[model samples]
Target: MTIKPHALKKGDQIALVSPASRPHSAEALARAEAVVEKMGFKPIIAKHALSINGYLAGTDEERAQDIMDAFSSDSISGIFCLEGGFGSIKTLSHLDFSQIKKHPKIIMGSHENTCLLTAISNQASMVVFHGPNICSVDRVESIAEIKSTLASSTILPPVTPSLGSFPAGFHHTSYPGNAQGTLIGGNLNAIASLMGTKYSAHFNNKIIFFCERDERNDIIERWFTSFYLAGHLKRIAGIAFGEFPDCGPKDSLSMKSYQDILTERMIEHKIPSTFNMPIGDSSLSRVMPIGIKAKLDATNGKLEFTESALD
Candidate 1:
């Protein structure tokens, strides 16, 4: 039951929600709504999208209610998270996966929202989006792809090894080969948090992709080990390591960098993996459809979206 959301048509209403944290401010929220309108869809802000409660946009109950309300609403063709922060994990318990499954539609967000994306896709059996939150809809980092992904029913363009779509950085191929599987990934820490839980997306026979920011290589090494120990990555076909900004060694350049850790781990696991494939926090990052099948050609350095996210 891999449910595909219908491609959004112009004039469709896109619900704006704060499943994590509210946008930077009311003004930022306004701008994000404007971005939605500019993309040719009406924006319907959730009731609690602007409610501030400690670090979260609103209480877990409020956030969960807003998400479910939009999913259950026939008028809302898609739902976009306002910002990425710490609340999606908290709101999960309150969510009714049955509601999402019954009314399957697009739910797009990135960063900490990974918790929700992975959960809904796995537990609810529907496609979810891995892309910039609404706050970044117009940012140079993710605008083009966001617009393209929302309306297209065709396959997303392949990310080539030339690294042309990516920003200037350390892009490399860990193992040279090809693999095709359901696209499964998100923020490394967020996805890893659900390792032993029912919410976790099983990695067996999947083309895994994950990313992080402002994290050290050592901690990343530990996360990888944890996944391996949990037997999550033992049979992964391949991996796409997204941008790791400020993840290198500041204490010493000689220390094994982020690149070193990923290179070593991929080689050790014997997985056909590659780094820097425009996953997140990267300028012009690709808007990937999670829970959809995809092909990873590490040798050719081109990751292909084998299926469209939308019907």
Candidate 2:
């Protein structure tokens, strides 16, 4: 399969579409617009970006139409999902993959956006980044990484683990081992929802998994169990668990408590895993290039790039 690489240039135009969840506040939407403006790209906001109906950005048809319009727009060099919620999957079937293939450009977002990213990667043979959404540019480091990546020529660098504390008791340490393979994963619930579907992200031997969790939701354990049952655990070579944003130990449980829950499962299956390397949804989260090759150094809790994602 021939992958069409979209070389992002400075001063290019990018459209922000809320294909999943709508912004919780007008301030959040403004922050996203501010991020795009600061990135040197002209930001185009779709009509549905501010339209909210429950958790979704809009109705399924509205969200899908915004996405299609963004891709079909000649002036837009890339499309960034504003934030992930729960409706991207509902609009996936309406996407015209062939049109996307013909007019290739970068489509990026993480969390629930994983389904769309993985499906496009497999079907369109394009490398889609699972990076921070516009709502997450509050952190200087993440914003810097995003800017550097989008402006860099021909390669994306690996992001080292950023150590920090969270109100919820976030923590990280090396696991004392290393593994390498193509990066494949996202929010556990997001990928889990694709199981048994034709759009499911395919994995094989030696795949380094990149997964993150959030505490505002209740489906963490459920999705983890689903991935295991769907045979992802058996096929993956190593795992990197990003900092679960707002998921530190609180109330009846601590961050360690939740980590313990997943650690026990990984150990039971003998799947090597690393925890709390910030990548998304954390103040210290790094920009990781999805659909690219990378190595996981569990001993030092570092993720190193094995090749140029732009290549």
Candidate 3:
């Protein structure tokens, strides 16, 4: 069964945990805290949120423990990852999925936290947020919509022209068809890393939305081919491509663009897909709920949620 967390309130206390990388500095954390407070929610820093172990926030066990503690805590209404770099996968085995399943709460982040989000979706069957991290809290221009999404249990509609500012690809559609399924997916690199693991997403009969950044077209092609070889692309109800900023071909001699590579793959499998979705490593991204049922209307360029992500 799908487990939805309770809707957040103005006074809800959110725990700031670093499941992936540590904050850039103490100043960044303070700014993040200030932004959360300005949003009218209490920010509770996780015990080891700032511990740095090379690039990671802390030891794998310590990072995992923060998540466990947050979910098990009576005071914390939600858990927000401080930032996403790498290391979340190391904590996967240490996490108690059962404990999180028993006490579902909003767990939100993007990029490297894609592993955690997918794991929670598959193991806990809980609706989780895929959006800005604590690092992006202060940088985003307007967070009113973000606050609204977190504070209520409401179905979200597809991206409209006015909803976001995307590049030219946002208007592109691969196939003219409509399909509905529970939303599943996140960063392309992170999602691909989950292959051959227990935490890998079950894309069968689901609307998969994926994004990437700082990768070359060749690497993107390889990852897409991996999904196809794994039989994930053949079984999905539909596909939605998100922003792939700074992902151009490393070799100038390569003729195909990143969009061409993605489109050819989807067409090869005849999957109903849309490109240029606003969710990804961009400041203009909006919150997208994983594990929630949504309709992918490729014919009309829309992805409308059929249910609320929270109770």
In order, the Cα lDDT scores of the candidates are 0.84, 0.73, 0.85
Off by over 4 Å in 2: 2-4, 25-27, 163-176, 206-213, 216-219, 248-256
Question: How many angstroms is residue 142 displaced in model 1 relative to the true structure, after the best TM-score fit?
Answer: 3.2
Shift of residue 63 alpha carbon in model 2, Å = 0.8
In TM-score terms, candidate 1 sits at 0.94
Q: What lDDT score goes with residue 49 in model 3?
A: 86
lDDT of 1 by residue, 78-193 (tens): 99988998889999899999889999898999889999999999989999998888886656436556777878988878865334543544457888788999889989989888
For model 3, residues 110-141, the per-residue Cα lDDT tens digits are 88999999999899989988887777665545
Ranking by lDDT: 3, 1, 2
The TM-score values for the models, in the order shown, are 0.94, 0.87, 0.95
lDDT of 2 by residue, 64-131 (tens): 89988988889999888888777888888988888878777877788778888877877776777778
Q: In TM-score terms, which candidate is top?
A: 3
| TM-score between candidate 2 and the true structure | 0.87
